[model samples]
Target chain A: MRWKCTVAYDGTQFEGWQSQPGGNTIQDFIEARLAVMFERRVVIHGSGRTDSGVHAREQVFHFDADWSHGPDKLIRALRTGYPDSIQVYKAEEVDEDFHARFSVVKKRYTYQFFEGFADPFETRYFWSTGNRRMDVERMNTAGKLLSGKNDFSAFTANPGEERDDDPVKDLSLLRAERIGPRVILAAEADGFLYRMVRSLAGCLFDVGIGKLEPEDVLRIRDSRERKNLVLTAPAEGLFLDRVWY
Target chain B: MRWKCTVAYDGTQFEGWQSQPGGNTIQDFIEARLAVMFERRVVIHGSGRTDSGVHAREQVFHFDADWSHGPDKLIRALRTGYPDSIQVYKAEEVDEDFHARFSVVKKRYTYQFFEGFADPFETRYFWSTGNRRMDVERMNTAGKLLSGKNDFSAFTANPGEERDDDPVKDLSLLRAERIGPRVILAAEADGFLYRMVRSLAGCLFDVGIGKLEPEDVLRIRDSRERKNLVLTAPAEGLFLDRVWY
Candidate 1:
């Protein structure tokens, strides 16, 4: 039987979502727990990778197991002795053909920004923009210009790194909304390149703070090339909100 | 000159609010910073001490320092090299007669509870009551019974510990409000005994979940003695919200 689980993690103390030599990543912890439960090696696959300090609200993963117990017991077993920062909230059995990584339909990411100095509680999840005032309308205007299917090479980090994934993606939504002292940027796409959301967020933030014009963003996107002009927002401000399957 | 400062701390990584031999308390950090700024050691007096894992939103402190720089510059200097979990946000010069511990007129504390299982983001700030259904009206009824001036020995912890402070206090307000899946209990008083807020929270939580009746709480309060029946909620769920002078 195959089990699919929806999980959330604080991500502040993690070394990203992927496995590494140090064994400090979220995947490492979950896999170790699975190993202890099964008394053998078991591998679980995540929908995608998130950088260190990037939080997840509903990250999906799947693994093959032969347990006959129901989902509730499985959830309870998985949550035992786990750190409070990570939670496996939902679990269910899925068909053998279902894939956690390949079955994705769309993904949504949200970036949080504080208008001024963030309070102690918010500093972990938000990026403080100092005392600068952001123009939400201008940010949205620039975000709209970058929406839809396009070659987002300008927003991709480590352009020199070799990868087979295409640069073009259908960005269905790119919008910014302001609530009190917080500015949230939501982005939905069929697929995102490496650090694509962070790059887009950095560009929109620059536009909102009058560092870049809306037309400048268009020019940068149309160039179809990576440059130093586009900055990648810090990982702490990014959150993987949803992954549709 | 005497300066009053309002600070907030995450409290998850510190020993407590007082100066301890380990030098891991919030006061130790602030005094260390002040020592670095001035040539001599400076002592700061907080409104009160909070236990480990107890958060604060506006914990006030006062200290005497001969500094010519303004409050804004002082704030910036004090914030330098400080961990993100602790923040000193507001600082102002006050009369020498003003004291952080003695001049307080009222203090407000908030205890947070989650109806079901709390998510990763909320685990640090809220106590999960499992799947139990809480009766907010019953909790409030019990809370009101415990309010006003009374000798609240039943809600005090460490009864055998030596102390000169009186157990009688004027509890101006005690209310419980439910917001969606979260229940917040706010308490305002002229002063609180050691672990009094947590004890009150635990009793009210028991009443909310039908483990105790409203009249049971009244009996406990009127007992004027500490007992094993009144549980003290964990420190993480309690927040020192405000201190009024």
Candidate 2:
């Protein structure tokens, strides 16, 4: 049976989502636990890979298991086997053809930043603006320019991943919202290139802090060059918030 | 000059707010940083002490320093001097008679519990309810029963501190509010006895889970015995939220 599950994880201690040799990755932990549960090797496919120090609220994945007790037992087994930093909250039997990665309709990500100085209590979750005030309106304006179908080559970073992935993707939402002292940049796209969300957020932060003009986002997008980007933000502030089918 | 500062910290990494020999305490870090700035030893008096694994949103402290750069500069210097988990946000010169400890009129504490299973991203900040559903109304009713002036011997725990402190105290607010999957218990009092907030929260959680009736809190209070209480919630869920002069 193919089971689709929504998992959440704090990626700070893991070497990202993909397993690589001896590195402590989320995939390695999950697969190892599943192996123990089934008494054999089982491959669990995730919707996408998140970089190190990045978090996930509802990362979807699929794994085939022949447990007689079904999805409910599988969820309980997984939850008991996994550590506190990783959990499978929801699981259900899916159509045999359903694929966690290829079946993805859209993915939503959020990057959080705290304006002014960093709060000691919130440092782990939010990227600090370094005591600088952010212009949310300017950030929103810059974010709008990057929405819809566009070649986001400027926002892509080759983090040992092949650069042959398509640069043109549909972004339904790229906007900024401020909640008290924290600024949230929410991005929903058909798919994101390697480090693309961080790159876009970093550029919008530049606009928010007056380092770049709102119109500069368009120029950078048209340039199709990653070297022209100002920043890639940081992985600690990014979250794979949701995956929509 | 006596400077009053409001500090915040993530207590997960420290041995609480009070200094112990060879222990990593918030006071030790702050004093060490201040000594570096002043080229001499500096002692800071915090309003009160928090237990290990407990957080602080705005712990107030006072220290004597005759630096020429003033409070604004002191805040900036302290910000740079402290690690990400500890910070002094606001500092101001205070009258000579002012005391961070004795002058405190009230203190507010918050204990956070996440209902249902633990979320991986929030494990560090919130206590899990072990996948149990909480009755917020019951918790609130129980919390209210613990309010007002009363002898809270039932909620006090001896933690090496002198139990000579008065057990009679006025609790202004002991309310429970549910936000999404998280239930927050906010308690305001003239002063807290050792582990009083955690004890009250734990007892109320018992009420929430139907193990105890709301009226049991009143019974526990009147009993005036520490053995009458249900439990002492973990320190990780407690926060010294604010101090009111």
Candidate 3:
């Protein structure tokens, strides 16, 4: 049977979501647990990769296992003995055709920013802007200009890296909202390129701080060229909020 | 000149608030920074000591220094090179007679509880009461019975340990408020005994879950004796929210 799982992780102590030789990534931990439970080598696939220090509220994954137990016991067994930093909150048997990676309709990511030095509890999750006040109105304007389907090569990191995914994606939503001292940028896309969300967030922050203009963002997006002008924001501020089926 | 400082810390990585031989305590870190600034060992006093894994939002401390630089520069000096987990946010010169420990009039602590299994982000800070629904009204009723001036020997931990402070304290506030899945228990007192706040929180939680009646709490308090009936809640849920002079 194929099982679908939804997991949340702190990500501060992880190398990233992808499996690596160090055996310290979230995938490594979950796969190790699955190996123990199934008494065989089992591989699980995630929706996508998140950089180190990037959190996730509801990251989806799937693996095939021949277990007769129900989903509740599966969830409990998966949650037991794992580090508190990661939690497998939901589990269910899905159709064999439902792929964790390819079945996605859209994905939502949120980036958090603090206007001043963040408090101790917030340092692990928010990017501190160091007393720079962000203009939400300008950020929204820039976000609107960059919305809809377009070639996002300007926002992709490591252009030389080989990948099969296309650069053009339907960016259904790009908006910024400020609550108290925090500015949260939410982005929804059918697919995202490498570090595209972080790059977009960095550019919007620059626009909000008067370093760049909304028109400049449009020009860069239309050019379909990667340049040094677009910065990739820190991974600590990014969170994978949702992955729609 | 004597300086009063208000600091905040995420205590997951520290031994506690007091100085210890391991040099891993919060005081050790602050004093080490002060030694770097002053070319001599400087002793600092905190309002109280928190256990390992206990957090603080606004813990007050005081020390004597002969620095000529203004408060802003002093704050910058103290903040520089210190770990991001601990922050000395406020510093001001005060009269020599003012003491961080002795001059305190009252202190406020907040203990947080989650009804179900806490998520990854909340595990470090909230106590998880798995599958238990808390009764906030009953908790408040029990809190009222436990409040006011009383000899709270039942709520003190390590009663055999030598200490200078008295066990009798005027508990000004003990209230439980639930916000969604979280229940916050706020307790204010002229002073708290060792683990008194945690003990109080535990007993109130028992009342909240209908395991103990409010009258039972009164009986425990009026006995003026220590027993195993009161449990000391975990340190991570307790936060030193404020210290009033």
Candidate 4:
């Protein structure tokens, strides 16, 4: 039977959330850890794949295992053996047909930064902006344009994916707010188009820095051309906050 | 002529903040970057040395360079040249006798934790706590005891260079507050004995988890015995927040 579990991981040491050739992948590592205890090869499926150096607050995954252990014991074992960068925040038993990715309903994300000189101690976890004051209002206005259902082809990175052919996506929410020198981008969506968050952040950053107008979001959205988008926000600023099915 | 610059770095890739013989260190990397620009070797003196996986908000450093560039231009160039992880937040020309460590009056530190369900995104940057809800209020009450001058030998890790007889430290601030599921520890002291913040965090974490009583701080403080301390808080949570000279 399949069991879905909510997990969290540090993405700095990973290539991305998905399996990759040679590079460390969060899924591969988790599967390895589970394999040791369950004595079987388990294919771990995640709600969504994140990029290198990205983080997730709560990620959903599922795997099939036959064991006498209860959910709590499984969680405890995973917690004890999982790499420091990866953790099983919670564990639950699901019906055999439950799928972590296809069943997910919404996802949330947060991006952070440090103003002035970041405490060197916290720099790894946050983007650093020495002293460039930003216009949060403009970024927020532009962010509002990204809300609702729309084609997000302009914001995706890998345009070759067939997702562009059916680019329309339901963006339930997107907001860029400022905290000190840091910016908090809280976004919620039924599901994200590839690189959509990064693309939106890049545009909002442009607006925040006075490089783009809030109205520019409409034009960018209408164009639906990935090449027409601004820069892709650095992977460091993006995070996967949570997933709900 | 000499200049004092406050620096910030992401220590994930380095051995630590201090210069060492073989591994890459923040100090060595900064010196290398400076050498490439000035065509000569330059040594930087930092206010503190943090360990691997540690971060700093504003780390003060001083260097002697017979260069003609202004602090502003030097700052810009240095920032542009350094890796994204290393940033020169601000640069100032200092009096010849200014010392980053000796002249410092107080230093503040913070420890961050993304408690519960290890978030993949915050994994490297925040410590994770699974299966246990954090008792922030208890941690806060215990933290208050550290606000004034006290014998802190029990709260420091390594405690290198400082003799055991020198256990007294004047602390100006200590706090543990909650922001979301995370805790922010704000600590300031005239000067910290080695590993003091991390050591305190370990004990406080135990207190938050109900293992240590809030009043137990007095026992730990009075014991001046390192053997009684719990595990050192993971390096990832520690941040050099600020300095007041």
User: What level of docking quality does candidate 4 show?
Assistant: acceptable
Candidate 2 lDDT, B1-245, residue by residue in tens: 89999999989879999998975999999998988988999999999989888999999999988978877888889987667899888899899999999899999999999887657756767888875778999988887778899998889887875657789999999999999999999999999998999999899899999989999888888989888446999888899999998
> Could you give candidate 4's per-residue lDDT for residues A1-245 as a string of tens digits?
77778777767668888887773888878887888887888889899788888887688899888756888888877876557778886888889878998888888987775666555445556766656666888888888877898988787777354543357878887787777677888888887877778788777877888888899889988887867547777777677888877
Compose the digit string of candidate 1's lDDT tens values, residues B59-104: 9999999888899998888887679888998899999999999999
Clashing pairs in 1: none
Over 4 Å off, model 2: A161-163, B134-141, B161-163
Clashing pairs in 3: none
Measured against the true structure, the TM-scores of the candidates, in listed sequence, are 0.97, 0.91, 0.97, 0.78
Model 3 scores a C-alpha lDDT of 0.92
**Candidates' interface RMSDs, in order?**
0.7, 1.7, 0.7, 3.5
Model 3, span B116-223: residue lDDT tens: 988998898899998889999999999998899999888987845588779899999999999999999999999999989999999999998989998799999988
> Number of the top candidate by lDDT?
3
Interface RMSD of 4: 3.5
| Chain B: TM-scores of all predictions | 0.98, 0.96, 0.98, 0.93
Local accuracy of candidate 1 as per-residue lDDT tens digits, A110-198: 99999987888889899988888899999999999999999998899883557677899999999999999999999999999999999
Query: When superposed on Cα atoms, how far off is each prediction in RMSD?
Result: 1.6, 2.6, 1.6, 4.6
